[model samples]
Target chain A: MNGFKIIVLAKQVPDTRNVGKDAMKEDGTVNRAALPAIFNPEDLNALEQALRIKEAHPGSTLTILTMGPGRAADIIREALFRGADDGFLLTDRAFAGSDTLATSYALAKAIEKIGRPDLIVCGRQAIDGDTAQVGPQVAEKLGFPQITYAEEVNIEGDVVRVKRRLERGIEIVKASLPLLITVNGSAPECRPRNARMVMRYKKATTLTERQSANEDYLRMYTSHPYLNIEEIGFKDLDANIDDCGLAGSPTKVKKIENVVFQAKESMVMPATDHHLDALMKELIINHTLG
Target chain B: MNNIFVYCEVEGGVIADVSLELCTKGRKLADQLHCQLEAVVIGANLSGVEKQLYPYGVDVVNIADDPRLEPYTTLPHTSVMIQLIREEQPQIALMGATTIGRDLGPRVSSALHSGLTADCTSLEIGDHEDKKNEKVYKDLLYQIRPAFGGNIIATIVNPDCRPQMATVREGVMKKEILSKHYVGTVKNLEVSRYVNDSDFVVSVIERHMEKSKVNLKGSSIVITGGYGVGSREGFDQLFELASVIGAEVGASRAAVDAGFADHDRQIGQTGVTVRPKLYIAFGVSGQVQHVAGMQESSMIISVNNDPKAPINAIADYVIQGDVNDVVPKMIKYYKKNTK
Candidate 1:
């Protein structure tokens, strides 16, 4: 089997999981600035999966691509430090407030510029929106097969076998080449950055475009030109205007509300195995679960 | 005007509990909007699903029951849902945020070029005076969910789309009860799209059920230890106490990192969000992210030597002593009480 090229899609999002007292906005939307910006957790899991595949196939190259503001370059650097072969930062002023559809378009264009990849991996969903739509939508835009909630992935010849986590049990699915996988948090944790790789590639590439590198720093990335960051723009990918932004998005938000569930909550149950069985039966009988 | 539609998810030839929850909720929203509530059931052998929806207050049940829909695939499911939405033109649609709902909702919303809100905690009816269909067009659906983690709540509304869509999280809303002698209209339909073999890249060979004893998310009494628990031995005390109570043992994110417990048992933003009835926190300083998950518990008891620990703020009962000392006493008390 030939060594495959893989790309991991990552996003830099506000850590919405830890909203504090100052997290609210005056008008009730989320005060995003109050939250810390971090790399999407599942995306790191996706990167781990990609790195495992690369390890399985020795010569395989793993690439990281992200679309965000300039600070997103930090995630790219983190990816490089972690042994990714290449990185691309798709940053542009035009890409803002892009829902899944528009976000996928930009990512798909960036993926196209990177050339054909055997596997395109992404986190199942970003925590901020929790939409879980971008990975499948990107695959749709690129006209490829998508396997979501992939807990485990294995490649057998030309076929890609994956364990997709469903509601009741696990579904073992097999697809042909050139597929997209959206990894769940259940995937194995990512390996720490290699010490040697970190020393060698700390300044191995120029990504921000705005940064000025010193001579010693410039010498580090000069050896492997392939490791250099490729920043693609809207014009480079030639994305369709109607399919790229708010104009292409059909979903509209009419109103936003804050819900405080003031329920009369109480439970009547004895804490024992027998009591638990009876409680389970009660819940099942009440149709809460079965 | 077209009525509100609820995507009744069925697995193993039975309607999912969340679908009933949505139908019940959708019934209220429809009534608030002054529209009829309709149930849309799409799956294989979905014969008895319509009758079940009636008790939940569905006026009409649309069925797209087919052999191809027997085992769920994205292609067939998305095609069926898109076809139904186009034909019925439902003003509002709701689905549970289960595996199937999460998979199918986005695809259908994308194909229809509409906005969809996922994992919503609340749903509301909005009144918009756009001169379209006056009744249906004037009605809006507001999807409310906790944003920026669970720190703040956000209400999002999609007004322009014909069918307002939302995939609600499981356990967030209450499921409706089914009464006897319930009846509703069921209309069976076929898969309308020309789905080619080329479109589907993957084929499901088999389903394997991996039975795991521990599911911290659904446990009633969750005993979680944190970094302050000191070592794996400290977490073992928590597990012992949990076993005494016939409960599941969980860990804070720090405990999982410290190898004190498995990742599956970790409760927080990065792990499972549990709303257990009785949450016993041992040596855990409550982080905001961790609190987001357990804040809704019926009762919280904290055991930490630090009197001013953040966990004390949220805990209903605070034990100002070392968990190593306090946990054993609690276990003894529990044993004595139970006996």
Candidate 2:
């Protein structure tokens, strides 16, 4: 059977899961600069699914498509180290302040430019903005069907079967080729970086990154063409200027308030036998516990 | 022409609770805006489904009953919603943030270029003054949600979009019946006009939807653990304590992510929201997301090793200790005192 082309959408997000004391500033806003940037957790799961499909189908090529600042190339290199064939970094100043809709527009345009692959895979949502809209929005823009919360995906011939994780239960669905699937966090964890592949892709950098690199990397790019990660900006795609970033996004953040919970009067006690017994007695008397 | 619309989800002929909740909220919004409340239900064997929604102050019920529409597929549902919404031109559209709604809301929003927010914690009708544009939009649906890992609450608005679309989780809004005898008209849609045969590209093969055993939302007392609980085995003690007290067991998002608890038992902004009478948090350093779900509990007890765990701020009683030491002791003391 002939191999199919697959694309995996990914993002680089702040490590919000491990927010420390310093993660928030005095003004009650997130201190984003202090947080370490990492590949979005579920996006790694998506890359793993794409890699499996590529491995299962001979001659299949998997591409990673991500839209963010130039730093996002880090996740692409990370994907390469895990078995992806190549990657595209969609970075431009115009893409800033783009909500899910505008982001999907930019991504759909890039996918069209890359020649609509047979399959597209992405994480259900990004951690920075847990709005799981971009996947289905992109599918709508590309005029393809979508299966979300996918836990497992199996492909045979022209048909693909997907296992979806729902709130109450599970549903197995089948669709033909040329569709999109959003991987759930419940899916298998991505395999760790292979030492051999990491060494091969350690020098892979976008053109912007290559320009800032030292003289040795410039010489290495000439000898190894595959190490050059393709970069796409606003000018590269056929898109209307109004439909790019903030102009394209319909939803606007009217206001942002720092989350503050009202402090309640509390009796503080140490974990001792006496304090424990008294606390239990008080709860039972108050009809709070039995 | 400009009214409020709710996309009611039907499974085995019964309307979803979230849809009814939206209808309740939508009715209020419609009244505030002086518009009528309309509900759209698409499924097979949907006779008399409008009876469930009319009580929620729904003025119009749009039904597209088709055999193929029983189990929702993304394309057909999206097609029907987009066509119906375009014809109706509703000012606001709301849906449940369930698996079906999340999968369908974005597609419809993208098709119509309308703004859509997911898992909104609160929805209010408020006015927005665009200072930069010197424009004022009156009575807009303020979609309030916690973002950036629940560090901040953001209020979003769609000033230019036709239908300000938003999806709220099932338990986020309260469902109330306006009147048992409230009357509304039902408009049976011609399914062929709204959808095409090509829309049925994806088909459901197998399905197993079991009723959730843990009723966190319905329980009066809840015992929750966090990452500090350590491992899957550590959760066993929490279960023992829950069994002793007849409380439901819940977990923080961190605990669920750490594989110490099931995702269904997670109580946070992303998980289930519960307002039990008594909430006992063990080893939980409450992030805003976790607090968002249970801050309304009548009484809260926080047990954490850290004296200044964030959860302690809203807790009625703060016990400084380890979950391993505190849980077993609490269980023992409760048994002794109650007996």
Tell me the deviation in Å of residue A92 in model 2: 0.4
Tens digits of per-residue lDDT for model 2, B166-253: 9998887888999999999999999999999999999999999999998999999999999989998889999999999999999998
lDDT of 2 by residue, A100-119 (tens): 99999999999999999999
Who wins the DockQ comparison? 2
> Against the true structure, what is each candidate's TM-score?
0.80, 0.98
Chain B TM-score per candidate, please: 0.80, 0.98
Worst 10 residues of 2 chain B by lDDT: B168-177
Number of the predicted model whose TM-score against the real structure is largest = 2
Residue lDDT tens for model 1, A99-138: 7867887898889888879899999999777789888778
Please identify model 1 stretches exceeding 4 Å from their true place.
Answer: A1-5, A13-38, A54-61, A194-200, A205-207, A210-224, A240-290, B127-139, B192-196, B210-235, B246-322, B337-339
Docking class of 2: high
lDDT at B194, model 1: 33
lDDT tens digits by residue: candidate 1, B62-106: 887776665677766676678778988888888888777787787
TM-score of chain A considered alone, across all candidate predictions: 0.83, 0.96
User: Which CAPRI quality tier does the interface of model 1 achieve?
Assistant: acceptable
